[model samples]
Target: MPFPSRPVAKPQLRAHSKYPSIPSPSATYLVPNTSDPVGASLGGVRVVNEGLVGIGRLSGENVDKFGETQGAASGLYITDWAYASGQFSGKFNVLPDRGYGDGSSNYAARLHEVNFTFTPYYGTSVVPQTQVQATYVDSTKFTYQDGATVKFTTGLNPDTVGGVVGARTGSLFGQTVGLATAANGPDGAQESLLSFDAESVHLFPDGSGYVSDEYGTYIARFDATKKITGLTQLPGAAQPNRPANTPNFDSFTAPTTGRRNNQGLEGMSVTPDGARLFALLQSATVQDTNGGQQQTRNHARLFVYDIAGANRENPVAVGEYIVRLPQIDLNSDGSGLDGTAAQSEIIALGPDSFLMLPRDGNGLGKGTTVPILFKSVQLVDFASASNILGQFDNVGQAVSPAGVLTPGVNAAATAEVINMLQQDDLAKFGMNTTIPANSNTLNEKIEGMALVPDLSTEQPNDFFLFVANDNDFQSSDVKMLNAAGQVVSRGDGRLNAGITNDAMYYVWRLTIDAGAKFFRMDVADAP
Candidate 1:
């Protein structure tokens, strides 16, 4: 059967150049003629390279109509220059047997989501189920892979997996998982997820690459069935070089707990050469000893992992740095106040560096009128990241009230990272120097980021940026940016428009190829 697809209308586009360029400059765009005067202005040149090339929503006709279609639209694998759209097929089995405690069904392991497309050079993509047990309640931390359909779910300490729904197997929890016949609900009552957390897969010419998490953990390898290739509990800058036995898993020392309660890693992006890895971390602590429960502790940090060294078993953190602002309070809920967890999702811009989108906190900015100024994507040097394993004895460093930048290899090169965070850099593209009005509306959780190839220009690095926003139809604001972090494009408003901003939730992964082909599978709104 044909998979479902959604078309975006008036698809928003912003930029800093007269046209989209490779390695987009650190700038903003001009404002469009819209209803709200204080709204974001658009700038530079707006270019729509390709439109509706592929679809990335869950199966089922009326699935969750509130999510943007998940799929790739730009990047290295440009399928056709002729502008012709591409197509592919996959399966999602509906499981009815799995049930949550509240008289509702869940789509955990019995039937995970499976979907994939091809890249110009790397034929068929192969992403099997990585984390089987993760798909339990409608609310667990399950990620979608080549064979899985649930999108990447991050944040929220006690993660839940309730939305995954698909084909059912007669076995679960080590028993023969079976499917039920009834549907469940609290909010996205259907659906399920794979076994992994935030993950990135590189489809090598031979389908062999490492699939690691933020904490530098290589959970599994991607072969035919997403095989259980290797595991390193003690993952870091070092290589353990241990052979995999049955149920193999590593046990590296966590950078947190060991230190001043300062290490919690998330967001892992590998270099093109696969020699280095970059990680983003969220550190939490109470600024004032007498504040309320959630207010007393919260901090966020960024670190780098150098794999080129010899000690594989104990890879040390070679670089470290802090991206903070005086008025930027991590402890405050959306209001930029005190005592909030300043969170961020990271992605690699190139081999030399990466970018971070730090969300101030979970506050709605309703009561207090604190401007949300911590939503910019700051660029940073990969080499300059201090070794968490080496420094502070692998016992992660504390991110104090004043965010710190513990220089790594190329501290001087931080200009690129800082420029992307500048208000002027964003203004060039006609974008608001501050956070957009409803910054947190669509979960504002940017999990995956990829650059779309635009060869017509002199620079090839300036590709398009596609962020994976998890809130399905509820907040269908899958942000599109130029290489420089400008709001150049927005999700298709068609399938996502008219729906209440809260109608859906969760957009997991965002993948792109040279052919302008893309894939973005959602764990919540699969219809």
Candidate 2:
């Protein structure tokens, strides 16, 4: 129904050629407007060529459809994504189905869909080309509170259905014992279910979507055949609770105050006139960090919702800000600020702006040789921020307790739009940003982001973006499934013995500066 104004289709030109031809736009991939640091701190925002046009790849032993190992094994891959533009067939991308799976158990939180095709070369010569291409196509899973689709168990157990108990409770890293759901017996009597750790996603305009959860940092609302109709619950300062309001979907305990056990709600985004819905925080919470330092978790927290009426699944938490992130120098030399480049995905672009990303967790499937010093994307801007929704939605309310910011707050305004570790724009596309990393380097979770428009009737205001990657599934060729979706194992146990990370993608382009009031998203071009 909305968001996808064209420019994605391209790939079908055959005539005595073996692909790789496309090319045209290149003014040497244009990008220097004095290298916009978000147009020198938001004075209208122009990028138009961090332009690496397109590149995509999926293999790492692809598989999906219960044969398991889709983007390689171990927490599977693509931790967040969404794209659309496929009415009669051709441009897709959804990815979320792989939450508590690879670390074992707690399965059932699905969302697969992939179809992709893009092409785009607009070259000034970027050697390694792929121009986007996906294909897995179908999966839906999620249904909880006994609508069926059960199993959920990662350990702390308390889900029991036909034997009573059921409200929630399931852990993955927060082990309390040697559990593989403890052989499914005692522990409130088994049956099990409810653990979901999806991460982030947002799609709407009739196909219904919105899935954010690092386990009970919950935001569910599925439909379009993906089931789970509605649930929002975030605020209790982003819930983990411990023993206070009780939730705690343990990523290894340490809760007592919300989100920071594996930092919840990774990043979600809606607005392109879908009327707001943001939700970030892949860091800072647990009473807004200070001693849990990593540069004090760089403040984080974003949230904002008001899903444009008809009770879009009860989403109404107006605003809340605090965006700091970006701390780096984890021994990259001048040594001091030890990490917190946190933030992983987001895109919005109006209703107060968006586009986050933030990175660095070392490169190529993280067997870490360090060196990735901050990836980019940035440009937050809650129009002069400082909302703190109803004074920090509870749980020892902190907004930055000791690490600062809470003296009349303010926060938001970031800026840096796209530098994804440039390195000659990723060595003109053959990737590899350096560090001992090889297999084409560049990937230690760039998460997922989307954007679209470049329907270009002479560049209406450009746009494209895209980005992606979350290959934590570190594949060495994989297949694994067992929790009874069957296919039990085929590889991935050399402990990433020779690293494999495929599923990457990056597009970039950008423009939007006709004085920037940006909105564009009712989509309609392709015909």
TM-score of 2: 0.33
Each prediction's TM-score versus the true structure: 0.44, 0.33
Off by over 4 Å in 2: 1-49, 59-61, 64-67, 72-158, 161-213, 216-236, 240-244, 248-263, 267-279, 282-378, 381-411, 414-466, 469-485, 488-504, 509-527
* For every candidate, C-alpha RMSD to the true structure in Å: 15.5, 21.8
Q: Model 1: per-residue lDDT, tens digit, 1-527?
A: 22223332322332222221232222211121111111111122112222111213322112212121222111111111111133221222111111111112122211123333321211122322121111111111223332343332211111121432212222222222112322122233333322222234323334333344321233223343433233323222221111211111112222212111112343455555445656544433222112343333333335455655352223345554433321334422344344332333455544445545444432222222334333333444434433344443222223342333333421212211211223322233222323323332322323333333322222322233333322322223432212122222243332323332221111111112212122211112122
Q: Tens digits of per-residue lDDT for model 2 on 1-527?
A: 34444454332221221211111111011111123232323424443343566677777666667555555211122322333344222344445434323335434456566766665665555666567767777765655434333333232323433343223454322321112332221133344445556767776646667777675676777766566666676777767766666665556546677787667788888776677888887878767777656677778888888987776777888888888876766656545666577887787677776778877677787766766666777777667778888787776677777667778887777766567766656666788666778778788777877766554333456556777776745566455444434445545632334767777777776666535434644344454
Candidate 1 least-lDDT 10 residues? 32-41
Model 1 CA deviation exceeding 4 Å by range: 1-196, 199-205, 208-221, 233-264, 284-303, 306-343, 361-374, 382-388, 394-443, 456-458, 472-527
